[model samples]
Every structure is written in structure tokens, then in C-alpha cells.
Target: MDCRRSRTNDPDQWIATCPEGSKAVCEELRDLIFRWEPDLKESVNSNMLCFSQKKRVCGISGFKNHAQLTFYRGSELPDPARLFNHGQENASIHSIDLPDGLEGLNLRALRSLLHAAVKVDTEPTQPKPPAAPREEWPMPEVLAAALKKNKAAAAFYEQLKPTYQREYKVWVGMAKQPDTIARRLEETVRALAAGKKWAQRKEG
Candidate 1:
């Protein structure tokens, strides 16, 4: 599938145009879910068709050879049919894959899994883990020297977020030739002094 043209709001279009052979089967499964619960809303996210009511219940992703039905809160769902075969180590998600050449799916088992997953989604939620702190990237010698030479640039560089600083660091570090490195360091200082992020400068 040409992901660039994918409609983020339409799951049917995603399934219809996916290059995967198992896409037909995926469509069948999706229809079954909609039939089971008519109120469930569908949308495409991160190259997958996500279904949700109050919270995310499940998502379907189509690959070249197979398709996957991923449960957002899958780890908590019981599987008497033992349908969940992937993503077991993840704390919050569980997935079932339909590999190429699989003849047919057990509809009854799949329905049971879907209903169980929805039940989990509707249950009371727990407090989520705190977000991780961002790591600061070490300043490269070339960038540091350039910044040191220009007080305005130094202040600007210091004020940038760690992620933005890393972009400059990585750009300067990737230049192999001495002249290339020197030129990039010069440009970096000029860009910082102008309050522009790396790669944001207009080309002449």
C-alpha cells in the first residue's frame, strides 16, 4: 500500500488497497467486529485500523504476508481459546497474527476474544506510569568550540531542547571530510545566532 495516500479516517479504504494477501481476511474480521458492536468507531492510526468505543479496544494492521489484530489492553484479556500468539512480553498489548496460507479462521474463537477485549477496555483503568525524563546529548567538540566563540549562538544553543540540540550534534558529527565538518560547524553557529533550527534555513 502507498501509505502516503492512505485515508486516516477510513479503515475500509486501507483494507481495500493494502498489498497484503491476507487483507481480504482482515476485512472479514473487521466486518464481524462492526456487526457484533454497531456503535464502535473506526479510524486509521500509525498504519493500522483502530476500533474504539470509550477507549481503544483493538487495531488491525496489514503486512506484506499477514495481518494482525492487536488488542490495546490485551494483556488483561483472558484467552480460553488461547488465540493471542504474539506481543506477550509487552505490559499493555496483545496480538494475533494471520499468516499467509492459513485456510480459515475460527470465527467463534475470534468473537470470544473480541468480546473479552472490549470487556477489559470498559473496566476501570489504573494510574499510568510517569513519563520518562529526556536525556541530554553531549555537545560535540566542534559545535562546542563554535558556540564558545559566539556568545549569542551559545545562548541560543543552550536554550534549545535536548532533541533539537541532538539534531545539530548528529548533523555536524556525520560530516566525514575536515572541510565539510568545518563548513557545517560554521553554518550551525550562523543558524543558532539567527534563532533557526538545523535544516530550517532557506536554501539560496
Candidate 2:
């Protein structure tokens, strides 16, 4: 969908765009947003139809394969069900993937989730570590396990320069427990295997 502009939407009473394949879904979602927050202002930013409470709060975007509701404060969303990937454990970035039809979303549940994302909080996420002091480290057993278990991670490890491999080791070693260490090691390996440098960052 070429969602290049915005106009007033009907039903949900929001102003939005008609991206190609998902035009119907977009219109329905826009109406849903209006129903959820009738007084909210709607606009366009970063190619997504943005809704805000006096300032930027969230937006909806269209894509060929899927759509997404971009929650500006998604990391803080209280999704104890672990619905999102690497959500709270990472920085502020988070997202919920929309299928081609949005058939599974319960309108009330979605509204509640969106409302939680809009709530303000002053806490900054854990700060990114300062650039590591330059050093070389070995490929730990955790990394080796990751490579052995996941093909993509193994490919990534093979492609990374020695320095990058060292970086991965240092990152996994920071986990305080054997279980936590194991989980992170698994995730990092899979992320690397998929050609992702920063798996926590939001992406299409």
C-alpha cells in the first residue's frame, strides 16, 4: 500500500490513508482507533498514520506482507503474557505484528493495550553499555551451543569478524544466572544467524 498521505476516515472517525493491499483493514483499524479515543488527534509521521494525546503516542503502518501498530511506549506495555518479542527486556522498542486480516484482535483488548502504551512514565530503559574496552575473547561454550543448535546463528558466527565474535561472548557473559545466560545466548545466536545486528531494535 502506498500510504503516502492522510484523509478523514469514516466509521472510526479517524483521518488515515489507504495503503494498497490492506486498505480495508486500514480503514477498519482507523475506525477502531477513533472508537477507542474519540478526541485524539490523527496525523501522519514516518509513513504511519499517527495518533496522539497532545503529542506523539502511536501510529499505524501498512506493508506488503503485514501491517503494524507502532506504539511509541510499547516497551512499557504490561504484556505479562509475553505477547511481544524481547519486549520489556530490551529498550523502549516494541511492536505487535498485524496479520493480513487482523482477524484475531479483540477490539476491547487492543484498546486496552493501546491505552496502556499511552500512559506516561519517566523511567529510562537500561542504558546501552558504553563501548567495550577493546579486548579479544574466546568463543564460549554458550556461543558454540548456539551455533550448533541454530543454523542462522551458526552462519552469522562464521561471517562475523573475530572482533564481533568477541563482542557476542562479552554480551552473553554479563547474564548473572546459568538459565538467564542460556536464554540470552540462544536469542543472540538466533538473532545473529538471521543477519540482525541489533535484534532489539524495531524493524519491519
Clashes of each: 0, 4
Off by over 4 Å in 2: 1-17, 81-90, 121-204
* Alpha-carbon local distance difference test for all models: 0.79, 0.65
Best by TM-score: 1
Best by the lDDT measure: 1
Q: Report residue 15 deviation for candidate 2 (angstroms).
A: 7.5
lDDT of 2 by residue, 73-155 (tens): 67667766444542344456676667746686666667787677666433454455576586666667767776787887778
Q: Which residue pairs show backbone clashes in model 2?
A: 1-20, 12-31, 152-193, 153-193
lDDT for model 2 comes to 0.65
lDDT of 2 at 5: 46
**TM-score to native of every candidate shown:** 0.56, 0.50
21, model 1: CA deviation in Å?
A: 1.5
